[model samples]
Target: MNRKTLALSAVIGLLAPVLAGCGGSDGGSDGGEAIVVGTTDQYVATEDGPAPLDPAFAYDTGSWNVLRQTIQTLMHVPRGGGAPVPEAASKCGFTDRENESYRCTLREGLKFSGGDPVTVEDVKYSIQRVLDIKDPSGISGLLSNIDTMETNGDYEIVFHLKAPDATFPYKLSTPPAGIVSQKLYEPNKLRDGFEVNGSGPYSFKAEVKGDTVVKAIFTKNPDYKGDLKLRNSKVELRPFKDADDMGKALDSGDIDVMTRAMTPEQVHSMVDNPKEGVQLTEMPGLEIRYLGFDTEAPTAKEKAVRQAMAYTIDRGKLITKVYGGMAEPLYSLIPSSVATHTNSFFNKYGDANPAKAAKLLEEAGITTPVKLTLNYTTDHYGEATAKEFETIREQLNGSRLFDVSIKGAEWSVFRPKQTKREYAVYGMGWFPDFPDPDTYIGPFLDKDNFLNTPYNNPTLRNQLIPQSRREADRSAASKTFAKIQDIIAEDVPVLPLWQGKQYVAARDDITGVEWAVNSSAELLLWELRKGTGTGS
Candidate 1:
């Protein structure tokens, strides 16, 4: 399950003070000008199930950003974890007498973009449908304990879990839990050709497909009652493929913002010093990059081999050289910003010591020149990934305990192979599905776990995951998770390499932008302005 996957509010100070308050600014939209932004289409079109524009079907972050705005959830994370705000629901929670049951009542006047009055049936069906999909998207596994789901009223729905699950609210806060209009989802795919029938502040428009994909427009959902924190009426998402193109776009004034997916060099050059019209800000990301050992492979299953290799590698050099200091070296599965992140692993495996590495191999009953292959995807993270591998190879071989061979695959191809467990060892990067330690640990929860890696920890998978999810309180859940991570560092099925940083550049005109802990590059579209709107 090791797929290799935030903040408090991260802040960025610009060289220029917050743009001056302009008259009739309407979110500082350059005074009545349309605010256009760009990003790349990372996924190419595929015939596979008509491409899951339905967030319920897949939990990719790019998709989550759109879905969270489109659908309604029963309970949500409030501004200060306030009482769950009503959407389709007036308010929802479990009955005191029955801790396992969850319930929500609807708000009035809410309608899907298609104008279907959101109802309890729609909520039940939308949730139940995920189990039917069985790919489970990301929420399926989390929802497995549902013993029953029924609508108590037209606007109210109840879920009876097989066990007490406190994290359920946080789970609902996640986009996959965003309720879909049963009216929009047909049998297996979307009702229309992937166009979202959203209920949020925006509606989907044109989509341009290419190396650099751009979505036409999404204006405020006129019926939006959920969160009006956003300041703009429209949003444009265009992919620049990589940072170089984004940098160029920022420079040429073709795009107003450069956000997300910048490499080390690009970060140094464009983030703070991009061409005119662009403003750059860098923040630590809710992302982590790591190395996974295919325990499914017989040779990799040996704990000694896994441990020895882990001990032998030079992570510091890789971060410094390959990542260009854009990344922070990580010593544990959980990252720095996340609660419960511990340096226990670092306490065990200090900076790379070739002598210690060789000794570890020798003690593990392995002779020098232990040969192995490591795999990575080309163009997935940055140009330096391959170079990172090269640095790793040098470090391992420097210890004279391992002979390393490196291989590269394009992400589209690499994704399937990793899912199939074809590589012996590989580089994996994960963007958190939900901004929680659970999302990080949940993917690699156990083999056949979420990401489908074969690295199963019977104790953690069967015992820990259920144990955590079933807790009556998330604080209690975090307690169990602390022990679970101790187990992770002890086992070392995957090695945590580095924590990534997210960088974004916006048009001086863009506003209402705030950085969440997860590094979502989140913008409440309605919060953006030109001459007539307000960003924050």
Candidate 2:
């Protein structure tokens, strides 16, 4: 179930602004060819699925995939990754040193595909509506710092913050703040039906459906204004139930691109064994997999018991035996790729030490063979999750200090229940909303984290977090981040398990595979195109 997730947005001052769609090949001159993309059902968006298409309500990757292309955000994590850049905004800057007031001017002549003019009012409505609707699973929490938004004339929008927040701009670059045409959407409720009215590189054309969505067709938005260029006139998004089917689709040329949820075994079969007209591209290791311990749960409430679990599990074995080395062991909440990430856990525990685990349990007055149940989402993570959890069960039981039982819950039920403190110990995966180190640190430590664990240290919740945000220099913020990681290592609120590598299998004739995955590890279908020649 553990795989890399999605990207986030940002603002403070427009740092390193790149013209959207400025550079990169237009997936080889259109040619009116339709690119068929293959993805597992886990990534396909449906009205009946976990998320709704309304920009304000969609939170999962399936929804994000549709939203990112259809709707333009004020800011974006550039295709190649760096500081957040203005995407829809012609210009943006902070008005105060405390990082409270922010302003943005929309690019002139912005218009939705439906021919509605995009105005500051639409931008203001998009931000305010998210706070108003506040879907429990939505990104409203990211906007908690905003006090109010005011629009001036037709193109200017200003945001007033309740508190100083440097990362507020980054949040602006995500889907939660995607500009929606006020004429097409209601302020207090999610938009009904599949019709999308947006001003991005693509527009919703039609959907091919059966019991579930078989294919979603997107055509280029002729009026779209940005740095992106559509490589093909149309994009056909096809959803498969399994990775094996996705791989087979790519091999048979039924699809031009194969996206997320491909298992390691399926990847090896395509890359190692060789598919005549297929190519596999591996992405940066930016995603994390971790185990959360609910502090309210009896066994987990004991610091010694939590520490013992951290000390006993072998992450190396999980990476090698289970993932086949597609991932690397992680020791801190922030993956090593992030600037402030430190292997604090590894520094303390070294490796799986049975003696240390037993000693810690004895000190806590907890007996050996601690019985506990571990939970994981069956549908959200991937098919490999069951094996992954079984490996965890075996590892803990092998320690002789824990008697572990594994359980599965559907994501629809699992996520809300976990947030409600229903699970004692569980596994979860994180995809960054933005590429900042703070994205990793802040959310998990927030008073109401996803698991809503009862561990809250003032040093982390109040002081370090806000202090890190106030420090304008990211490098200066890292010192506070390092300290927090040290604290998390001691607290054992969650144990970092593994960092994942992105995988994309594409037909050899696809020319833009290199640029298909932007800096944020997002698949840009607009960057893909069909080449005239076949297999090499």
Give all TM-scores, in the order shown.
0.86, 0.90
Task: Locate the minimum summed-lDDT window of 10 residues in model 2.
Answer: 10-19
Candidate 2 wrong stretches, greater than 4 Å: 1-22, 25-27, 41-51, 192-195, 205-211, 447-454, 532-536
Encode model 2's per-residue lDDT on 100-211: one tens digit a residue: 8999989988889888888888888888898897766636767767898888999899999977778877888888888888877888877755667788889985364532
Per-candidate total of colliding backbone pairs: 44, 16
TM-score of 2: 0.90
Candidate 1 displacement at residue 209 in angstroms:
3.6
